[model samples]
Target: MAKRDWNRRTCAKRGHTTYAPSEPELRERLHVATAAGEAWRCLRCGDFALGAPHGGGPAAEAPPVLRGKALRDLFVLRLLAVERGLRGVLGVLAAWAVWKFSNSQDALHQLFDQDLTVFKPVADHFHWDLEHASVVDTIRKTFDYKHSTLVYVAGGVLAYSLIEAVEGVGLWLGRRWAEYLAVVATAAFLPLEGYELHEHASAVKIATTVVNVLAVLWILLSKRLFGLRGGVEAFEAERHSASLLEVEQAARAVPAADQAAV
Candidate 1:
């Protein structure tokens, strides 16, 4: 009887429940335990891992190297660039949604509510006569006053918010993936931005185009995305050394040696 009771207790301790634990429950338990447990902390990121991916893996024993100011600056720039890129994308989406639900409003009317040949070059280049296009007619025909294009607008806002939020978080966490994503997303919209500038050539359009180009350049050149190893770090080290020397000199400077010694 004693041995049988002990076996049952042992089985219970070993997770021998009548029903299997759901994934979420198991995950929650693991998370709780990990949070309470002591583990190795990453020097660079301050993240803790339990013995790395594989037992005694290469990553488990490696020490985090010090990052230089250049690398840190690159990280910071990446964060800002991705955030701005997200905003740019959201701006496009918002514009698209507004156009979609405006009951086939003329692009010229939508652009600035002034009747001008600003879009003429675009129409000629694309052979798209917004004035008499069948697609425009169909859109107008299908339009209703009660129609709320708010759905598209809401979707665009939500998508933009979420994407930007993710990129922001990834950037804050120093993820390399976010930098690439920012670059790709920004590059994808260059053509559209160029077109917009060409269509209107307005101050706003020009500023938008310039900002996007600068952002791309910042991510590519300043951030040192996909550069050879140690290059960014070396730059950072030089910057840090210069700063340290400045600080040291400031510390050594005396205020007229208190005048008595002089």
Candidate 2:
């Protein structure tokens, strides 16, 4: 009776021959052999392990490659995240402006109503016109600085900012509900965006409208939202089929008898 070697026992249990060299040594050998256009032959099975350098049992499979629509969908999700993030930032700025204007109503009114005798002399020196009644009137009307109006605007902007932030986070995390929310929100703004374009056409306005429209369409069609294009079942099936683990298992499947024998 002799003390059983654990390493040999483990190898026996796995039904594979164990190499004496360490992993690093095996890797180096495999690397050199592969560069020379020769395969690293396995000791137990007498088969070329090709690129496998680590003990030559089974070659490590590469991660599942996302191609075609899967890759496009991921890119779209990131794009949506960026768009939502920008909207969130704009909402925050708007909210801040509302708060500042609301708090400075008295100061704003005083500055606008004060006499401009000294400022007129300075303006004349600089060849500036301080007597533009239309400009002054517009400024006064725009920044009436009503506390109630400011409060209401700030509340609206704050709520919108929260929604944008939530959509950004959810889209970034690739949540399904986030996709639906993004689609709905973006679609809701399309009509307003279109009307703005009709009122005042500009490159920025056109680009924004196009991007939002495309985003809405992509989410609806690609994600199979609202019972379109085979719905949720098909969408989930596509995701499962594209999974790395699933791909690897399918590619490396062996017969039951072969697995038992191994």
Candidate 3:
């Protein structure tokens, strides 16, 4: 069975990137004289694309076109960005809820009391001790918080939401600073997440923790963050080498690659 080419597959969906190489040797490898004027090899999919090159420049100035593993890494980053955006939106909603609750705590408590009264008969039938229920006790504790305290809580949540939203946008745009920001921000709150899990274990919390851990680990290693795996230098070098143009450039050293292209 043949292995799949993710880069080519992605290019097929998104369209190919072609370049006109002004250098004689570079153009010889990339351009083929077709009856339809000319065909230049796609820098991404590596297929002969019949169209005017969108841009032309010296070989050294050719745009960096990502392929293979580099494209996969980009997909992962965008996916992670989506997750961050969802979490950010949720956080904002929660903050707004807390803010509203703080403003109308007394009215909300009255409504809660009425709801509880309505459910009294059902609770008795089920032999549920509503008065001493842990969940009810926890809910009641919210009423004891001062308005200022609630406002502060809401502010904190809103701030966290903003951070996540910014990180999401940055990662989606493939900004280098965003990668560092994501690592620092997510890792900073890990201790709190662990503590929350320790206080009350739940499948959702466990899953969230696992996802966050895996994200942090994957970003650090795959992106070579914090000097791991030769750091930014190695990461850049690897990305550069993945380009079809770079592959062809490397071929100049080995004559066999030219024949192989034929």
Candidate 4:
């Protein structure tokens, strides 16, 4: 039997006799049957094999890799974790500031009460004046934090900071419980945020409130919290169905009848 030149182009455009493989010939040669209207091109010359005898062999194509919702979920989780981490840091700073002020209350009061003459030389060296009564008043008002109040405030801030840190870690690890915790913690503060806005509205306060609200809503809805929107099963199914492998398989199967007809 003569050896068939599989690499040669069989299309008229390539100055060769047009040839297309029959179903059995294609299956024997390429190990896969070609569908009707599916043109096979020569691997070497990039020409279509004419007629039903042959066309193009399957190109060396890799299946699409699917990340789908998994990728999206990871991105969202990381973003939330970063936000929580930042909040945790701020809480820690606030707690530290309170504790420091509480311990140095006496020293700060004495410093404020002392005459400007005591620090005149240092102030002059730094090209600054320390003769303002308002500055002393401000310091006095700021340091008016009672020892008991400072202790309580610092304790609360420390606790809050720990919670934020835990939440951040859990979120970064993509824990489902962390999503719930975040939603509850954020929602619990909404009322306080509203009250703050009512008392003294500022751009920062408004922006913070809006961001928290959006984050809470996004987690609740997107994560399908509390069985919303067909629940976990549906969500998982959607993710699985949207996978690249599943999609590609579905696409490949569409021409099954056509291939059979050939």
| Each prediction's TM-score versus the true structure | 0.39, 0.64, 0.93, 0.60
Q: Spell out the clash pairs found in candidate 1.
A: none
Instruction: Give me the candidate number with maximum TM-score.
Output: 3
lDDT of 1 by residue, 67-164 (tens): 33434554566557565657757766775666575655445345532332576578778988866778656555534333355456556666665666
Best by lDDT: 3
CA lDDT, candidate 1, residue 197: 77
Candidate-wise lDDT, in order: 0.52, 0.69, 0.91, 0.69
Clashes of each: 0, 0, 0, 10
In model 2, where is the ten-residue run with the lowest total lDDT? 16-25
Q: Write the per-residue lDDT of candidate 4 for residues 1-262, one digit (tens) a residue.
A: 9754433422222443222334343333323334645344332333454344333333213232224355466668889899899999999999999899899999977776675568878988987766565775577777787898998999999999989999999999887889899999889989999999999899999999998899999888888888988878776677667543344345666688689989
> Candidate 2's residue-wise lDDT over 1-262, tens digit each?
9854433343345543322233343333333355646455333332344553334333333233343456557667988898899889999999998788889877876886675655788878988877775777677775765788888989989998989989998998788899999998888878889999999899999988898888888889999999899999999889767643344345445554488898
Over the full model, what C-alpha lDDT does candidate 2 score relative to the true structure? 0.69
Pick out the ten consecutive residues of candidate 4 with the lowest summed lDDT. 57-66
What shift in Å separates residue 204 of candidate 3 from its native position after superposition?
1.5
Between prediction 1 and prediction 4, the one with superior lDDT is 4
The C-alpha local distance difference test score for the whole of candidate 3 amounts to 0.91
